[model samples]
Target: MDRVLLTKKGAEALQAELKNLKSVERPKVIEAIAEARSHGDLSENAEYDAAKEQQGFVEGRIKELESHLSIAEVIDPSKLNVQGKVVFGTRVTLYDIDAAKEVSYQIVGDLEADIDQGQISLSSPIGRALIGKSEGDEFTFEAPSGEKTYEVVSVSYDV
Candidate 1:
């Protein structure tokens, strides 16, 4: 599998979720299954069926999180030597030329992309265009709506 890129914060969040699932959720599901089994009639028991379904889901998620963590290449923005260019884990301020609006975005890994939270995946169109660019540089790209131009106002590695 290809190495998965993850910011330090994103990796920490995933680790926390994995810990919760393993320690708290797994034990609760096991207890629920045991309790349901005590009720008898495993074939027709609705409680048993529900517990089994929950177990399957929890186990699947655990495996998925573990696989992701195993392949994760965590990047710490503060430790990166990107100079002034936009790169993964860099927060950038941009000015839209057509709309005359200013927006801020953090270039992050695909799994951590959340536009509402001002984070854009490195593979995204705007993020791809911004990579290797420095402040005061203007670039144009094709957006879904139309062609859009943006000027890089600032770049920082700080969160």
Candidate 2:
């Protein structure tokens, strides 16, 4: 199978979620199912059906987390020896010429991309354009609205 890209923090978050699912969510769902089963009337037991459905969702999430962790290629930017060029897991600061403001974004995996948190996936348009760009470089990014001009201000690999 193909490998999945993940930042160090992203991988840790996924592992924590997996652990919570197995240790907490799984047991909670199992207890709920047991309690519903004790209500009797297997044919018309709405509580039992709901509990079963919740169990299915929990189990499916567990499997998905496991599958992702199995193929995860976690990249820790702080430990790398990359130069000034922006890369996966590195935070890039840019000066938007059109907007006349500065913005920062951390390049991360697809699953860890959160626009609200200033995290962008490496596959995203701006992220893809930031690759190999160094500080004091001027570049044009094809934003959803239109082509925006931005200048690279800084690149940091802080964890």
Candidate 3:
């Protein structure tokens, strides 16, 4: 399987979630399952059914987290020699031509992307266009509404 790329902060967040699942959520579900089972007649017991369903969800998440952590390639953007070029983990400030507004985004792995938080996946349209660009570079990408043009105002890996 191909390794999943993650920034230091992303990896830590995932690790924290995994720890919570294994140490807290997993055990809590197990206890619920046990308590439900004690009521007997699982086929007709609502508590038992709900607990079992929750257990499935918790277990699935745990497996997914384990799989990701096993092959995660954690990169610290602050330590990279970006040399003014935009790349994964770089925080890029852009000037939208049509909107005439400035926006900031951090190129990150798919799993860590949160557009509301100014993080975007490297494979995303705008992210792909910005990759390898430097300060003052301009690029265009197809957006859902239409084509959009942007100029790279600045690129920083200070994070």
Against the reference, the lDDT scores of all candidates come to 0.92, 0.92, 0.91
Q: Candidate 1: give the clashing pairs.
A: none
TM-scores for all candidates: the values are 0.91, 0.94, 0.96
Please give, for residues 1-159, the per-residue lDDT of candidate 1 as tens digits.
877899999999989999999999999999999999999889999999998999999999999999999999998777878788898899999999999999999999988899999999998889899999999999998877988999999999987
Rank the candidate models, highest lDDT first: 1, 2, 3
lDDT of 1 at 133: 98
Give the backbone clash total of model 2: 0
Model 3 lDDT tens row, 76-102: 777877788998999999999999999
- For 1-159, candidate 2 gives per-residue lDDT tens digits of 667899989999999999999999999999998998899987799988998999999999999989989989999888877889888999999999999999999999888999999999999999999998999999998989989899999999985
Please give the lDDT score at residue 10 for candidate 2: 97
Q: Which residue pairs of candidate 3 clash?
A: none
Clashing pairs in 2: none
RMSD of each: 1.5, 1.3, 1.0
Q: Is candidate 1 or candidate 2 better by TM-score?
A: 2
Mark the regions of model 3 whose C-alpha exceeds 4 Å error after superposition. none
